[model samples]
Target chain A: MTGRGDGIRPRPDAAAAYGAMLAEQLRQGGLAEPRVRVVVADLLDHVRTTGEDPVQAFGQPADYARAWVRPLSRWRVLGRAVATAVGAVGMFAAVTAFFRGGSWSARMSVTIGDLVVLAVFALGAGVLPWTLELWLGHRAARRVGRRPRVPDVVIRAGVMLLVLGLLFTVFTAFDPEVWEPVVLGPPRPVVFVVGMVVAAVLSMVRQPRSPALPRLPGTPERWWERTPGRPGRRRR
Target chain B: MIVAVVVAREDRESQWLKGVLDLAVLAALVREGSAYGYGLLRSLAEAGLTGLKGGTLYPLLGRLEDDGLVRSEWVTGSSGPPRRYFFVTAAGRAELEAGRAGWGAFAARMSTALEG
Candidate 1:
């Protein structure tokens, strides 16, 4: 079978190809459709049986049924708003603590610089994986059986980066002077802007596909359930 | 069964498995003299060491042939199919010999250590 360049291009096997594409789109669209949900479930079942990448055959689903849908409760929105307000106030307090000096201009510069550095750390750590994990988690969860476990590697790496990002942000916020080399150095604003542009470009590029899980010689025999020839036969 | 499940996602252990490919494939040929893809696959399955996937096996066999450890010939079988049968080369025999010595030493040491 011939492969196309991008976007799940149609193949000679039009029917199967179309079905896979449509099923994927439906999966992304909240996975609300029972039939499409079954298709996603079946795709996962095949992965469990054949030990292949389910999305390798298609692509990321459109609606991402396995993704954590935001809770519909009004309480969730209210709670989030309250927490965000608290965070905003804490951030103001942090900035207030940093700039207890006489000169207004100098304090503004330091505060703005601190905010930029904080933004870098959060983007590098939080925002990047927060966006990525939604899709990654959904894919990992749907790769197996009815009860999906978090893909350990993705979970571990994401959490590690987030924690490190938090530490970096906290450190940079408290000690804005540490970033003085870049902030006060020549072509200051140019450096920050260039860095942001480079980061945006890098994030846009598709992450490299990880190597396939190693396939052992005799594993498939154990993966599938065995059915007896006679219905009532005693078998372990 | 328990070990297989536990080690399923251990990538380091899987890389180590790659190091054993030549030995495993060579051992299969030593037992059968020569065999085709499905034949070797079945032999491995019967040996209760199964997890090999398609994306891995075919390319590995190609690499082995390229390295001259094993040579392949296309022949029509009684099953009405053209199959590529692989036979171990002299180099393969040498590699197997070295592996045997290493494995023997490792097994002996482990046995002694474990018993103690």
Candidate 2:
């Protein structure tokens, strides 16, 4: 089984990719790397003996990683809760400031209608991208037959857009007269466009490169059966 | 249609395997005294429990270790890379015994029910 050309020679690249992925997961899960290395070595031995493609045999690297980091989900949930709370507070302050003509110490005398409009804009600006990302991630996981680990750059961009849009909205609400000069000012649009384009390019560059596998034809039942929350099986 | 049926059956089997897998791994370690991941998996397969994926097994081992039911150590092979050998702890052995007893009783009850 160990002989070269005996159809069982280990694929070094695949083993390396698997090792890197496992290591990242272990790190994320706060496991000791030395301990994980022992397991990785053993798994590599299995790969050598069977000559099976690791991804095909074990499922997507991200999904495999996630299985080990199930405990991290609680922290993720807690973090999201904290973020939403902080965002709400910030949105309230921003909206209030906007209503007071961008004056921080202005009187809290805005009408209920004004408050409602600000709340709507704030929610739309802050929550829409996040909801969209989650929905897209769920859809991709089901359709692609693998877990969708959204890239960090994409996440950062979404956050940046959320913040920028919120700022723009608050500025407009503060005083429509002053808003145009600050946000849609002569050089601001050009800067925003350039920043967005650069961010998109960087995100594309940072995405993991993998050999594209052919997509299989999906049956209606299978499509419906694939719930976003369900862990996927290793597709051969 | 045939493919769909086979896929569904595999899905069901995988879910069933997940439930019994911890028992199987613990039993394998207890029987073997100590074994590395791949070697242990091969032993299980030889005993007729094949198709266990690495993704499934490694995390389970990690969890078992975390739960203090198993312990692992790195030992260098004479000719190749170091391997993590896992051994069943005393707690693990006790757990395995309890699990076996429970499973035996459950199986007997199910057998009687089905026979009826």
Candidate 3:
């Protein structure tokens, strides 16, 4: 069958559109033809209302898992590692201070900080499995476009890590005998500033190209026409 | 009168050809063994099925493959881009012969009906 000039038809590269059309054609030939008609109608509805390629819409869950979920998960792991390293150093400091006849309160406080850092690190580390599951699951779904069963093992593992991190933080914060420090070394201003700069640069790097201005699918353009109101006159 | 008869004959054949094309494509693959998409499309056009677009042909090939009547494999052409080539299966060949028989029966019945 030939394509009608219905705007609802997907522009060929949209794989989901291609799949839906194929499904309709096969079902019509072999099984109930009305079933194919209903599917085609639904597909047309999806296209007309959303202006989204249906396949791509189904792919949003995978995309979200990729661009946001996996990254956040990994960053949380990295945070845990940073906390652990800092805590380990605090532990060493506590031990040294204690040996040096440091005040009971001061040495004890550093020891507590060490414990806090380690706990956070341990909790954060558990997120790795969940991150891995999300990544692999998304990749598989993209290839086949079939519903994938989310592994309970991965989910439980992720929950376990989060709980562990929370428990550590709670215990450290609430303990009575473990003395808490008034300040933890220079307020971490340098780390915060550096982190903000790095975060800004990363955000800038990962920004999605606006899809409003359609580019050739899966290919780059030779020249870009800058939208009006942008800096600098158009250059060849 | 002769010119009018020729024109009428051409119109009837064109109308008949249009309906048979969907089957004609299946017959070509069943007979030819294998064909590249563009090559098959061009050949069909040369045989009088004209105005077929690249967009229409590619999707049809994909649908045929999906249905298992046709199978495709990607091969890198000398041009360096991969093109999907299609060949009919045993079932497809059987279906083509059945369709051909059905077409002949239908044509005979229609001719008798029209004459009556």
Best by TM-score: 2
Q: Model 3 clash pairs?
A: none
Best by DockQ, which number? Answer: 2
Off by over 4 Å in 3: A1-236, B1-20
lDDT of each: 0.47, 0.57, 0.46
Candidate 1's error at A165, in angstroms? 40
Which model is ahead, 1 or 2, in terms of TM-score?
2
Q: Which stretch of 10 consecutive residues in model 1 chain B shows the poorest summed lDDT?
A: B53-62
RMSD per model, one decimal = 18.7, 13.3, 19.1
Who is ahead in lDDT, 2 or 3? 2
lDDT of 1 by residue, A102-165 (tens): 5433322344456555555444443443345434544543443233465557676877788678
What is the lDDT, from 0 to 100, of the residue A107 in candidate 3? 20
Candidate ranking under lDDT, highest first, comes to: 2, 1, 3
Residue A201 CA displacement from its true place in model 2, Å: 27
Backbone clash total, candidate 3: 0
Q: Residue A90 error for model 1, in Å?
A: 62
